[model samples]
Target: MGERLVADLIVERLQAWGVQRIFGYSGDGINTVLGALRRSGTPRFVQARHEENAAFMAVGHAKYTGEVGVVLSTQGPGAVHLLNGLYDAKLDSVPVVAIIGQQSRTVLGSAYMQEVDLLNLTRDVASSFRQQVNSPEQLPLVLDRAFKAALADRAPAVVIIPHDIQQAPAPELEQEHGVLTTAPVWSPPTLVPAPADLERAAALINDGGKVALLVGQGARGARGQVRELAEKIGAGITTSLMGKPYVDESHPLAAGVMGHLGTSASGFVLGECDTLVIIGSNDPWTEFYPPPGAARAVQIDIDAAAIGNRYPVEAAVTGDAAATLEALLPLLEPRPESAWRTSVEEAVQRWHRLAAERAATPARPVNPELAVRELSDRLPSNAQVAVDVGSIVYWYARQLRLPEGVPAHLSSTLASMGCSIPYGLAAKLADPARPVVALTGDGAMQMAGLSELITVSRLWPRWTDPRFVVLVLHNNELAEVTWEQREMEGDPRFDQSQALPDFSFARYAELLGLQGILVDDPAKIGAAWNAALDADRPVLIEVLADPDVPLLPPFPAGEEKGGTMMDALRKEGRDTQHARDLLETYLRQEEGLNRGL
Candidate 1:
């Protein structure tokens, strides 16, 4: 076999590994890699505006497709930029591989133009694997190891290759045409819990009067089983933020989210249950954790380490959610309706009614909840939502009840800002036929999403299949965090950083040759979104809302008295309105339900 450039080998191996796209920015350090990509003509290189966005794109791709997301970048700043998104994948347990470029071997010790110690910069975040290829002969083995580690650990892996090494001659191997074998067949093994754990869990479920189910992303493929178990036991279902989209919102037992941005009805379900069946989720929020001593908890998870970490457990089943539930279901019997279960159901119903009332209320400066509700109701059948973190997450999570097929990709685990725009782009890349919508708060949009807007502009002309929409929840403040600082720290005044200066992100969208609409009126918000969905090019809709509106979680996250919230507002010279306003409508609806209204 003829000698081949190591660069060509790398790209060819990537193609053999089923990588269809490589998200990255080319630089002097990585020139050889990009050159090889062009020669191979198998894996397409998508040039991202920023290295960070490229990493996030890979993260989003891996998340939506359940495949290893691949990203590439030059050394130094480029490699450093990938950290944020890599950490995102790390914390979220998504599989991703990062290929970083390095200087020539000659400049290994010198402070060359682009030299920065890559290993030291990335070691903490890319915990699964981190290795640099030193020789041409080592390329295949190194690349293969990184790829396999990503799949096995469901975490990020980094590989750094020097330009000289990439350009070196590669040795022929034993395979046909002396083409060295790159990736071997790799797959994660399916796990099943032991019989004793299943039997113990089933026994607990059978003896308890009230049962509640808590689910997370690990329960994604087990939606049917989760729903079935809940229905059989007459149990209420509560989801961690990541699991919000797994179950259909219209399911009879669905009680919505738990923890920070969760729903009160879901909290009530957990508090009232005697047997709590927690599956998949390891959310650290104590408010959502199974209350100690009140219930016998049975947890099912693929990761054995998470079984009893969040709450005390009587039965901890270590297996896939679907397989574990299948083993336990036969041992359990149907549960009759009880007062606690009935109370939770009624609470859920009332909660929905109250949410609707709040969503319908017309705002003097526009209402975020109303905007989100309109979005939820009017989204096209195949629309995909990607919501950024901060106050807007509450609005999107609570008001937007996605239909059966629609998926909402979120930055929930990392809880990072500026993720929605890039996430929407990656979501579109995964499924080019669906309408992609990105929801962002004022602060989040300005943080990093604005640059992604430019990336959108650049990519708009290249494809026309799936459309894109960016919805900005414009409030000129971090509404949720503002409320939190006051309530948690008893702070007298909010940091000036909380209030974001007003910016017309829509106008910026127009400057980039895309459709942009700024709507301050409540009536225009829905119309703007509808128009954006039908537009040929990407569109940005900036809907202004009142900054004074309180962003409340499912329940109060504080242990102190009520004085903290009101007092802080007064000190800040902001609206000193009643905190009751946040829940007044809900309480009213609950009372009406009690009276059989």
Candidate 2:
């Protein structure tokens, strides 16, 4: 009230950019900025359990809402804690702006308490744009540039402000010589390839007898165009994990996600296709793509550099996916329904049967596949989903059928664990009217999900519709990495490193004043989902999943790796018979698929 400080100006600028909320934890270095945010009361501040979780929430907000997410933190440890989430944004190509606090200017190179070199620390994660705010006059330019860079590059940007600068008086811009005032202004550009490039791409597509499309997150806006393109060319579509939400999995030609965590149907489509069209996806699994010269590829991406990064491309169309596809559709000659289309559809049906069989298979208590598959039917049409890393991702990818327009996001490129709860929190905060479902494994829940549940307990009552449901697959093991060691290293699961301590996830949820349902029976899985969705408050459904379920890759690749896995299991010495049997079951299923039985 006395005079506007630099912190006040910073908050005002954020509001001008239409930021409704800022996620962070309070710290001494950032106390002044926190005070300004409290005083203005325009941009609400959501306190997170940890700086890492707060950063994940920021990334989640950007992913779900298509807006620039903002996060704040104090010096040293708080800043270091933000690295994982910031890297998640960087690897997944999300827009996030991190505003970090530094020690007072007087501390200089004295290495004062909590005074760390944040600029150097964040060099790689925020390589798109990183700067230290030295003066009040430079604050506006830095803030505006950070937002612009984040939006433009679809990456995280950093702005480090010293404690002294945050407390300084706001500067007045009156035709100043050494000061620059920047407004937060940006607009999406309409990018389409030239007519010649479009013609070439279309000609290549028309020439191929068997065509396939590999879609990624960047093609999210062009779902209709993608479907139309596939229909016109009689093509099968397989999505990168990040692109799964954009395409309708219910489509007959939809082959499901492509990669190790992908479906057998996707493996079939990618393996058989003669022409590959990569759209807006720079998926890292190049080995899963049509082998070397087996297919002629055309890549479409907004970022030109990413076009040929993953696979060799014959036609590199540097343009926005929706705009490029819209233009190219006119040039494409529709192909009549052919035998190739029939084969693709047949593969898809086979995968459906295989998945259902796997999900229904009996386990000691509950099959993790069944736990996730049950949610596919009960998931509301208006729900938003957040998936965590680990074995749970495999079930979510294979068993869950997301209705069109229901966005499901995760740490795909980074493959970072401990992200689901924070991501769900961000999605819920954006539009509390829409219910959110978060799926996580016990390993991730132990790392960060449990702490964030307390945040949910404190905030859920304020939501308009309290239908935030958390699904914890309590397998009591790091199942994904356990299988990784067997398949990759041909080594048994080491109890010292792979086993997790026992914890009561559901009871803990109840202690926090939320509804908790513990299900060890497969029959109760559907009912648990129903109750959670219908609950008046946030609910956590903990399922006692079996660790013996194999995390096998999709066939041919999976079948080839079977011998190595069998060797590792045999080395487990004892009590691994169930796991070996499960592995044999999956191998037989793949063999049947190969024989067309």
Task: Give the candidate number with the greatest TM-score.
Answer: 2
For candidate 1, what is the TM-score?
A: 0.94
State in Å the error of residue 272, model 1: 1.8
Tens digit of per-residue lDDT, candidate 2, span 167-242: 9999987676887878888887777688888888988988899999999998989999999999888899999999
Give candidate 1's error at residue 276 in angstroms: 1.4
Off by more than 4 A, model 1: 1-3, 174-182, 464-466, 556-562, 574-597
TM-score of each: 0.94, 0.99
lDDT of 1 by residue, 1-597 (tens): 335789888987798689999999989888988988887776888877799989988998888888999999999899989999999999888999999999998888799887999988888887779999897877887889888999988899999999999989866666565345665558789997888888888888898888888888899888889878887788899988889988877775788888767776786787678888888998777656656999999999998988888899988889999988887887889764667657767868866876787777655578788888887777888877888988788887788898876778777778888788888888887777778888888898888899988888887776645478888888788877777887677675465757688788889999999998888888787788788888898988888877655555454342232456666766766455543454344344444654657
After the best TM-score superposition of candidate 2, give how far the Cα of residue 568 lies from its true spot, in angstroms. 0.2
